[model samples]
Target: MIRINRRILAQGALALALAATGFAAAADTLKDIQARKKLLVAIDLSVPPFGMTDAAMQPQGSDVDVARALAKDMGVEMEIVQVSGPNRIPFLMTNKADIVISSFSVTPERAKVVLFSAPYSVNQLVVGAPKGVAIAKMDDLVGKRIAVVRGNLQDLELTKSAPKGATLVRYEDDATANTALIAGQVDAIATPSTTVQTLASRNPAKNLEIKFVVKVQPLAIGMRKSEVELAKWINGWVEKNAANGELNKIYSKWMGLQLPDMKKLADEARAIAL
Candidate 1:
């Protein structure tokens, strides 16, 4: 009988091992989450209206409400995993969260690495400054110091359109950026419209006013790349909640702003799911 070559068998075994590794790295996350029986939601607790600690020191905000609604739809308990602006996506990539509901905006760059569900909310980035500040438009920001939370959608948008002479001071989070604005360390700030309303209203003495609109970003849930089943489930849940009026009520309660048109988004998501 002819003897089999040991080197050929070794190479074949190595190729099989590599294939198995690749498959494991891309395991079916949806089934894993279902097996776990609890959904791990990543949220940013420092952003008000979207996330923050209530008087009882429990997490509460529009994002928190959305997470609860999703958990309810899935018939699973929600475990809130607090994350900061810079760390939320990392947590998702490292398998620390089933999904992120932290006002995550969909961008083409981000789409390469993570899948985004249909938008559940709309955010308008606006420039906020003292009433007497002369910033009336993007051009007015030239040479002025503006604070923005680094890596946030507001930061990316503002940086894109900022005039050449503008000083875009990046902070670690919303609270710090807002503090820098209030303490007169920065001439103005670029942030979510809801945040501007919450902070300015709470500190009326500061006389902060919306200087101009920077950009409008649609916020959606983010999950691991190629999680088609999970994406479909989330989209269907969002569509159901929107039609039942539950989503609108939650947004109204925390944001105090009229909900954006979600019908088009819901329809798109449903089409994808089907």
Candidate 2:
């Protein structure tokens, strides 16, 4: 009996030690960023207005500005890890990025894998085609070929909502999809409204126009599920920036529109959390 009791206590102690180690490991990301003086941010440069390169090939976009702001707020230098729609979460999960500031839309499916900060921006998933294509509703998508970035929210939502006889051509990323739309490889493309506008402005010959909106989604920062402390910090940062009009300014500068009501979105996010 005495030997058994000793063995049980030893096992309990070992278990407690392991739990403590795990807790520390999980909570250390914020501290690690501070200690290293660099915040590694993941972004997709292919997605213009949200993320893209300027004429000088330097990164310039709303998402890039937001990431820079976050790094500045944290008093750390920013290091951008370029990623695509499908690879953003993978990079975060693998520690290739500390956080993802790409146009990551919040959804129940994605919430299961990564922790999201309260929304800092909004995304309207829209279908865009030549002005001549008469697509005013979902049913009009029937018999149309739609292009979308594979494994993105646009792809998932379009897949769920598009009618039968619609063909979806999946591209590796937003840049490819936009290219296909311009090249007339697809009849329409499902992407963010801002992206559609950017494509239209850049390629007037395509005569691209928004056909209809599929969904309005809130965009948030994405971090690994274990990085609760880091997520909390980012959420606080978003709230602070939102209140000060900084986020709105960034949105207006790149997107040419006012930001959505972040306070309302934050409340909604809290309700979701509860």
Candidate 3:
């Protein structure tokens, strides 16, 4: 009799677990967002077009625009969080943030850690060298002192494929990297192509141009895997915005480009879905 009761209890527990998971899988993230009346979002204040503080020190950029539009659609307010690349995902998992609107690249390794929305934009990493020393390929970087921002994807990629004999110098921000390049501290600077383009716009230096030798990274929003509902909500929001061209308008106004065609990328992600 005891063994039978124990087995029954175990079966009941398993049934409840499956039922909960079934409900969780289809939960509407929008409903939770609306109930909160405000959604917490993380973004870097430094990266332009994606996220940045304006002259008035207000959050205003592509990331901000997208978040605001989504919040508006959900009928909620937004809580802008300033974050760095290193800790962005941690913040989401720890409930420090509900969503990440930073210029986040979607990678297989990253997807394993968290849920990612469809690609909303494309960001290419570019090389910037002093005048008379333009780099035509990755091979040209050999022996060149490279400057990069620490705690960023650029830093990771540079370390992974550093040119033979090249010395990698890392800084905390783009300003420092640009300054290092101008001061002759490093022979070249590498960063997201669009980010470098934004910096180049401010200084207008022939030496600070973004090179397209490297491939582009498709940018996406991030959420905790446990927050799959949030991911779907963001996906729906992106679909709605893209279908209406609001995403394009925001991209043109901030990043100075059209939204990337993410259908292929999305399908590819589906093939590798966790």
Q: Comparing 2 and 3 by lDDT, which wins? A: 2
lDDT of each: 0.78, 0.82, 0.69
- Residue 27 lDDT in model 3? 43
Please give, for residues 65-182, the per-residue lDDT of candidate 1 as tens digits: 9999888778888999988776677677767888999977766545556678887887778999999889999999877888877667666666667776787787878889999998
Once fitted onto the true fold, the runs of candidate 2 whose alpha carbons sit more than 4 angstroms away are 1-27, 270-274
- The model with the greatest lDDT is 2
By summed lDDT, which 10 consecutive residues of candidate 3 come out lowest? 1-10
Alpha-carbon shift of residue 196 in model 3 (angstroms): 1.7
Please report how far candidate 1 places residue 264 from its true position, in Å.
3.6
Summarize candidate 2's per-residue lDDT along 127-146 as a digit string, tens digits: 99999988999899878888
**Candidate 1, after superposition: displacement of residue 55 in Å?**
2.0
Report the Cα lDDT for candidate 2.
0.82
Regions of model 1 farther than 4 Å from truth: 1-24, 265-274
**Poorest lDDT segment (10 consecutive residues) of candidate 1:** 1-10
Candidate 2 lands at a TM-score of 0.89
